[model samples]
Target: MSEFGNLVDSIEIPLRWGDQDAYGHANNTVYFRFFEEARITWLDSVPMKTAPKGTGPIIIKTSATFLKELNYPATVQVRTYAGKAGNTSLESWYEIFDSKTGVKYAEGYAKIVWFDHETRKSTRLPDELRALAAE
Candidate 1:
């Protein structure tokens, strides 16, 4: 798998037949879902009550690079790494690999900002969540 930094979490996602496109490879958009799953899994590790009532992490930007085509009847392991953290935003990186063969399929990163649902503005990340991201 491509290394971005120290891995913080990982999850196995099974490929569904519906994930494939007319071209017979996994749809490009599916990679983003895999990354989302990994990111959510990592974030869920933090205490739910850490954030203020109306504040939570929201994706501000995301990007991915496909290295290989993913086919059906396979399983992928998505690994997440913690990146730089700021007062109101944090970075998360992802590496997707074939679970059995260990071949990397894609790599990506996302910038997530802490947001206040009520105010619709950026907010500071909770101390607990920030500590987890720093790890």
Candidate 2:
């Protein structure tokens, strides 16, 4: 975890050419995409009775802090972590950096709420996820 929170999952994604902006660097929105990819991957890996269409996780908030410029032609890794778990919410954090040199490009987090699609309200987190966050 190394002070980033409990390690949940990580993934390496190649920077695509279209990821760059007119400034020749990765656009600000790219960081959010990286975080989203990692989060989705993690969610797919977990075992839970509810699905996104049923009762599942939804991001209530998300933010990122850019540290360095990211460019194309590089493979970057995003390290995901479970920060804090409330009764019906969890904080998911991420660190995106170059996979080769391990240079951190950005750090971000998303506040996820276990939500019911029909009721359109928050629900208690799944037991599997609660156990994961306890770790």
Q: What lDDT does the true structure give each of the candidates? A: 0.87, 0.90
Q: Tens digits of per-residue lDDT for model 2 on 21-91?
A: 99999999999999999999999999777665689889999999999999888999999998778999988
Cα lDDT tens digits, model 1, 13-55, are 9999999999999999999999998999888886667544578
* Model 1 lDDT-worst window of ten: 1-10
Query: TM-score of model 2 relative to the true fold?
Result: 0.94
Candidate 2 lDDT score at position 78: 97
* Clash list (residue pairs), candidate 1: none
Model 2 lowest lDDT segment of ten: 47-56
Error of 1 at 84 (Å): 0.2
Clashes of each: 0, 0
Mark the regions of model 1 whose C-alpha exceeds 4 Å error after superposition: 1-3
At residue 49, what lDDT does model 1 achieve?
74
